[model samples]
Target: DQQVKQNSPSLSVQEGRISILNCDYTNSMFDYFLWYKKYPAEGPTFLISISSIKDKNEDGRFTVFLNKSAKHLSLHIVPSQPGDSAVYFCAATNRYNNNDMRFGAGTRLTVKP
Candidate 1:
């Protein structure tokens, strides 16, 4: 079963525009949600995170929303730049224990000039 899924493997956006990335999950016990931004041949870096207790969280130019009841989450980026063109992965962790996390295949966001 796909505990976590990012149906679309890639997304494209023009510079200075808003980019939205979507993710879905099957497991309900997942309480902590995280979004990671990755570059070519590099490890993913933590972007933003929200606890299942809350519905939304924001930081600077990035924002994340979590819908516990629906088991879904999304990431939004504003004023996207060419450098923002990279892979983004939606990941989730179990609530009960610090078990391994699940990551989406990844969504490559290409911000064209």
Candidate 2:
């Protein structure tokens, strides 16, 4: 069963604009949310994360927002650049069981120059 889902398979954004990636999860046990960016050949790299205790988290140009009631989360990138083009994955982990983590299929983001 897929616990996390990224409804949009891909997104295209112009440089300097904002890119938004959305995710939805079915497991209510999840408490930690994370966003990862992956290139064609490289492994997924951690971008930002948000705890269930908080509704939003931001790091520089990246921000992650969580809506517990809706079981949804979103990642936003400001001033999108060509270098930001990558596949973004939404991940979730339960605090009690850190070993078991769930990941979304991923949304490919293309930032046009």
Candidate 3:
């Protein structure tokens, strides 16, 4: 069962506030985690990623944390902007899978001005 789950299908936050997205995985063999940001009708862009050996990863205003024991991970966006409104997809796979990733339907994040 390669079920990568995002508990919430949507999240809304005010501009300049923090936005947090949560994800969980059922496969214990998944050792690589990634987060992608997508816009309508376009493919997802790689936002951030982390290996199972690491606990956290960050890039500019985005940060992702993983807890292997809990089979969970999260993405945090700081000082969210209206332009940040988009769908965020949480994905995971085993590196042995050659970076093939499975995604959650997505979490629609709306950052209001």
Residues 1-113 of candidate 1: C-alpha lDDT, one tens digit per residue: 78899999989999999999999999988888888999989999988988888999999889898877788899999878899899999998997777769888889999999
TM-score of each: 0.95, 0.98, 0.94
Q: What is the lDDT of residue 41 in candidate 1?
A: 91
Candidate 2 per-residue C-alpha lDDT over 64-93 given as tens digits, one digit per residue, 9 for 90 to 100: 999999999999999899999999999999
- Candidate models: Cα lDDT each: 0.90, 0.96, 0.91
Question: Which runs in model 2 stand beyond 4 Å of their true positions?
Answer: none
Ranking of models by lDDT: 2, 3, 1
lDDT of 1 at 15: 95
Score candidate 3 by lDDT.
0.91
Best by lDDT: 2
Give the distance in Å from residue 95's predicted Cα in candidate 2 to where it truly belongs.
2.7
The stretch of ten residues in a row with the least summed lDDT in candidate 2 is: 94-103
Colliding residue pairs in candidate 1: none
